[model samples]
Target chain A: MTITTGYIISALLLFGIGMNGLMTCSHQLRKILAVNLMASGVFLILIVTGFGTDGSAIDHVPHAMVLTGIVISVSTTALALTLACRIQQRLNRSADETAEGNDDD
Target chain B: MNGGLTGMKKRKQSMKGKFKRKDWQFATLTSLLIATLVTFLCWAILKEPPGEDLTAEALAPLFVQSGVTSPVTAILLNFRGYDTLLEVMVLFLAGLGIWSQATVDPTNPLVFSSPATHPTKPNFHGPGPELILATLVRILIPLMVLVAGYLTWAGGFQAGGAFQGGALLGGAGILLILAEPQRISTIPPALIRFGIVLGPAIFLLVGVSCFGYGGNFLQYPQPGAGSWLLLIEFGAAISIGITLTTLFVGGRPDPKRLKGTDQP
Candidate 1:
């Protein structure tokens, strides 16, 4: 197969793996990682779309779009992680309070 | 009583077995679905005919007018600047969301404030940073800053740009925070807030200023586009760096802790 097709196939595999992880994993951090993997697969597809089969010039627009995508993904990841940590903290606190009440009983 | 206890234990074992079986079935089904979807996508891509890229060709002739030699930079800062503008705002909003969700104690920036009697702490509790790591961080931080500056400047002509420089700066800031959390607290919170706002505010200002020159928003006049792009890049790099660092810190800095009123 051509190199472009190879890349496309791998990108699809990556997306599939990410999707599987997102569906199966119970951990919040793992879910975040899965989403990031999916984003990377999409980015690979975008970059490959701009790849020239012949001696044509590569598209700069896709590269710029990828850069923007990377930045957005980073920010979103940060926000998601912060939210996850907050949720975990709340859960831990409530668990501790419940345990304390049980001990008193 | 013994028979009842044994029956309860058997029931629990059966329940566990059922749950495990359900989990396996769910995983298999999901995997099958994902594999099918991916196969279809790949087939579609392989079958599609190659199309001509009109945008790249259109971008070629306008490179000089966009004021930067690097086509990517030109596209990012001049041609499709609105996307970058919104991107910066998105980053700003993310930082705002993080800050609103939790507060980090200034003295121990690693510890976030929660309503719980015992606040959740990260696993890496220690007396202080190790001597080797502290030294390494001290050595690397200055070099990182220098490289970040170079990247931002080089973006006008080559591959480097504000995002890369800002990410590097953010890495440096993370190292600094990790090595000396207390040192971060000593810096005024107001300054941090200013740094976070600097990039988007300047970007918006530059975009709005285009109207004064008798052009639409973000429409740079042909003559002075390079300097304007550079100005925006510098501001964006600083803001991105600070915002990223704050995000790593994981919450807003507590003003009370900064004032030394709260020792915890």
Candidate 2:
């Protein structure tokens, strides 16, 4: 197979692995990692696709898109992490109260 | 009847051993499905021909018209400026979301004030590491700011741009916080808030100002396009830096909390 084809396959494999992790992983942190992996896989595909095998000039539009995508991805990830933190804190507080109630009993 | 049924079930279970478990069957089925899907996808991707690069020729000449030497920056800030504008808004909205969540339950203490003020990861503890870290930060923060400034300026003709430079500034801000988390808390809240909004506000103002000048939104008049792009980039870099740093800090920083805290 060609080198470009190899890169595409690798990208697809990463995307598949990330999808599987997203579907099956129970932990929220693991899910976030999976999402990032999937995003990187897509980014790789976009950049490689722009570099066509015909030896033509590189397309700058896709590069620009990827740059924008990178920034937006970080922002979304930050928001997701914040939500996860809040949820974890709430869960721990509830668990603590339950333990205290049981102790009193 | 119940005794006979239990005996029959136990005999069947012994015969089957562990091979017929439901969870195992489900796992195997899902694995097979995923394998088949992946195989199909790989085959399809490999079969497709790599198309000709049509966009490069079409966009190359237009690049110079955008008043930037780098084609990527030209496309981002000139040809498709709307997307970047929306992107800045998205970053702003994410910060706003986190800020709103911060105020949801005021009964609970602010994020860093709880007795359990530890982060999820094992943070630096003890005076030795703290002193080393503080010293390193003092050395690196100014250097990072200088690099960030260079990167923003270099973006006009090179691979770097507002995003990369802003990220560097944001990283420096995070490092400062890690070295002394309470230092940021001591800052006036109004200044912090203004810093966070500065990028998007300037970007919007530039776009709207174009309308009054009889140009389309975000369109620069032919001779002065370069200057406008530079102006927008500078404002965006500053705002982006502050927004990213705030996002990393998490929660809307309350001004009242700064009272009685020792200054750095």
Candidate 3:
């Protein structure tokens, strides 16, 4: 009972915080962190929701499902971050070359 | 005394505020629609019953007899096997995306020799490698491996599971990548690909191991559940570790080379 309540409250909080971060933050890393926080919050609620009805062993179904959820989240986040970094690298390089050429000219 | 580019950003922001407010109606409508859809879906899922699920109850034959405490393990390794397969696919996609982007392409748009990020410094910091940091990393790597194994073993009975253990192991690999980003190697890639396949393979193998006993893919007996879970988790650890490491290294500059400064 307590666990579910805790998860529900925290999940909402995380959702709000993540939304705020996504809205206000511009850096890619910060955006990822916010998204991750939101994910973790939802996952916690799901696991809590799985708590057994007649003491049937805290619903393994949700646990199992969330297990996969975590993996997929991490994988997608990794790929997104890589994309961001690549873009940053390109931007930095372009900016540097322009600065160098202008200095010489 | 000290003037950097930070002040320019603030100035730009304040200057743009007066000229802002271009698409207020569109932004508001889109955000409201998204919020409504998200909220409605979540409420529906939560309101759904406790026993009306086929996927949840069908496991009676495949797993969870009458009075069991850790049916959770069985659910993870067995019943919901297809979901696990899809999860592996996610990791595979992440790894592949990173792989393609990180790979050296001659025609890709990037500056090779911009003496800006990496001026002609010998080691960029101090030297080839600091003895202390290297030694610390050496000590930590082996410990992380042991921890990963333990997390895998503990998942069946405790809160630790394959994904958690696998991701942690993968974290260690990412740390290693940070040190040697430029010096690309096939080992990480191979390991990730292996990790991608290894987890499902072990999971399916153990699940099928129960088929002869008149059970399905992940059905577990009394004592075999623990052992079988251990095996699957071990495979999970390896796969997750490699795939995640590959993803990070693929995006960053090679440990030995800068991203924009390295030439083909």
Instruction: Please give the CA lDDT of all the candidate structures.
Output: 0.89, 0.76, 0.62
Residue lDDT tens for model 2, A1-105: 778887888888888778777766669988888888888878888888777566677888888888888888888888898888777875777675554334343
Greater DockQ among 1 and 2 belongs to: 1
lDDT of 1 by residue, B103-201 (tens): 887777887774333344565567888899889998999999999999999999999999999999999999999888878778888888899999999
For the second chain, the TM-scores of the candidates in order are: 0.90, 0.78, 0.62
TM-score of chain B of 3: 0.62
DockQ of prediction 1: 0.74
Q: Which candidate is the best by DockQ?
A: 1
TM-scores for every predicted model: 0.92, 0.84, 0.67
Candidate 2 lDDT score at position B208: 93
The candidate 3 chain B region of ten consecutive residues with least summed lDDT is: B105-114
lDDT of 3 by residue, B1-264 (tens): 135466887778877764355335544565566467557655654566455455555665655442223466556555555577567767877877776665422121121222234322222333334677677777887888889888777766667767777878888876554444333443343443565678667766766777877775556665555665577668867877877766655532233432343542
Better of 2 and 3 by lDDT: 2
